[model samples]
Target: MRPQRRKTMGSMKKASVLLLLFLSLLLIASEEMVAVEGRTCESASSRFKGTCVRSSNCASVCQGEGFPDGRCEGLRRRCMCRKPC
Candidate 1:
């Protein structure tokens, strides 16, 4: 009976250790995800001429204007440039 009790205690300790390890791994993964993600901000393109048409065209003009990307947005269909803020 005493030997069986000891075995159960040992198994419980191993289970606790595994649980702690899994929790720590999850915490580290979450922190890395948060670090990788960022808020994106947008502004109307200064160099884009006329009303926005194709998204590809807007993106090209925004690239020349030093932004990472762009899109035609809103009812006015303006070329909006975007980047991490």
Candidate 2:
């Protein structure tokens, strides 16, 4: 009975160590992803016509203008294009 209890305790310790190792790996992976994420820069859309009303419309127009993303921003509601810098 004592030998069986010792075996169980040894397995439990191994399991706990494995769990900690897995969690540390996950944390490191998340940090790498965050580091890979870069800053985005924005500029006024050159091809967008008229006042920007909907962000979806602005995005489409900005795409046509060769930008990755767009949005209606600022007090004037101008279509602003965005791309990673």
Which candidate has the top score in TM-score?
2
Model 1 Cα lDDT, one tens digit per residue, 4-73: 9889999999999999999999998878443577899999999998999899999999999999899999
Q: Positional deviation of 37 in candidate 2, in angstroms?
A: 2.4
In candidate 1, position 39 carries an lDDT of 96
Residue 28 error for model 1, in Å?
14
Point out the worst 10-residue segment of candidate 1 by lDDT: 29-38
Instruction: Evaluate residue 50 in candidate 2 and report its C-alpha lDDT on the 0 to 100 scale.
Output: 92
Write out the backbone clash pairs for model 2: none
- Weakest 10 consecutive residues, lDDT, candidate 2? 28-37
- Across residues 1-85, which tens digit of lDDT does each residue of candidate 2 receive? 3789889999999999999999999998878443577899999999999999999999999899899999999999999999999
What local lDDT score does residue 5 receive in model 2, on the 0 to 100 scale?
A: 87
Q: Candidate 1, 4: how far from true, in Å?
A: 38
